[model samples]
Target chain A: MKKLLDIIVRIFRFIFFIFYYLKELVLSSLFIAYDIITPKDLMKPGIVEVPVDLKNDTAIIAFANLISMTPGSLSMDMNPEKTKIYIHAMYLHDKQEFVDKIKNELEKKIHQIFE
Target chain B: MIDWIAAFFLIAGSLFMLVAAIGVVKLSDVYMRMHAITKAASLGAILMLVAVSLLYVQWIVWIEALMVVVFVILTAPIASHMIAKAAHKTNMPKGPNYVMDELEGVDTDIPDKA
Candidate 1:
């Protein structure tokens, strides 16, 4: 049945995301402590606007939050229209590349599950 | 052997908490500090809970500890988001090293401080 296949696929994706997010969280937390432990030139901690396509409130909030727990990035605020989110990132090698990853990796997976 | 594993987790958890505490003091400004509190501290606490559950060696204790862990994982980020949002909205001071704050331009409703 198509419905059965959908449910099965969704469940697998759910498991995949849980592990993916957890792995990233633990690693990033270690990185944060490592940054503090060793004296390095601190990156300018500035906020960048991440353009978003997610409109559903729950998914949008989760998307914002998923980034926050990571080491160098924190979601500061969402725009009034939900079109963008402000993130305080420790580094920004290439903004467009970063945004593209968010869309391709995070937003797409989350959208499949919640939206 | 069980004790050894539990002790490792206990030590690990305590160390994370210690690092988090130090980070909170050493880190400047609110946004960075929030990172210390929620991420490091939460992980530390979760590890501690695991150690406690292991030390007690009881199913009920493990269940209860896991319940607490679940609650913590669910709430910590939400709490951090609230603080971050409020901090962003109210114009809290930023650290010296950070590059740019684009949010200042995006939020039109922020009243002129002068």
Candidate 2:
């Protein structure tokens, strides 16, 4: 019974993750569309270092891809130690806020799904 | 009514693709252009596929649409990541607004040829 319940929970979490990713995909595309249509120079591109907590290679790859697909951000490279990832953002108004948001939202959700 | 909804999605997807094209021309840097192409293009493709799946009643159409969406979503990030990494490796010039580069001087698998 416990094993069945665990499987059910995992499936539910996976479904939720897919919905969350879809939402992100739509919103981010809209945001980019708006940015492109406007004439103003609204972009402030920069590369910021995000510390990684997930150790598994599959998890890391998924996390990087999710980040890339999301709003204004792209995963560029990871350190040799695998402890940090370099992310390039088109509009990075605040570096610390960006790092914290990724950690709290994307990374946490990925951790739940993978682990 | 269903046709209207499908048309709306198709139009919206086309608009997104248009924006991506404009962005590629207007964006000042390689990284920013990659952002425009990868995210917007993939989402546009997915939306169109969704519209196709919605219009058709056949189960096979839905399955095919789902497969295409999966293929697009899976490949987009990997393609963007590879482009970004290559640009970084070759020391491609950044835009004027580029503020910070955390990856600078970090030795990875590829030696910085620039």
Find the candidate with the highest TM-score and give its number.
2
* Candidate 1 per-residue lDDT over residues B1-114, each given as its tens digit: 989999999998899888888888888889888887878888888888988987897889989998998888768878887888888778778888666678885653545579
Candidate 1 lDDT over residue span A1-115, tens digit each:
9999999998998888778777767877798788677767566677788888887888886787688776788777775667877777777767776678767987887799877
Residue A45's lDDT in candidate 1? 73
TM-score of chain A of 2: 0.95
**Worst lDDT window (10 residues) for model 1 chain B?**
B104-113
> Considering every candidate listed, which one attains the maximal lDDT?
2
- CA-based DockQ, model 2: 0.74
Name model 2 segments beyond 4 Å from true.
B110-114
lDDT tens digits, residues A55-89, model 2? Answer: 89989988998999789899999877788999998
> Which candidate gets the maximum DockQ versus the true structure?
2
lDDT (Cα, 0-100) at A88 in candidate 2: 95
The alpha-carbon lDDT assigned to residue B108 of candidate 2 equals 72
Interface RMSD of each: 2.1, 1.2
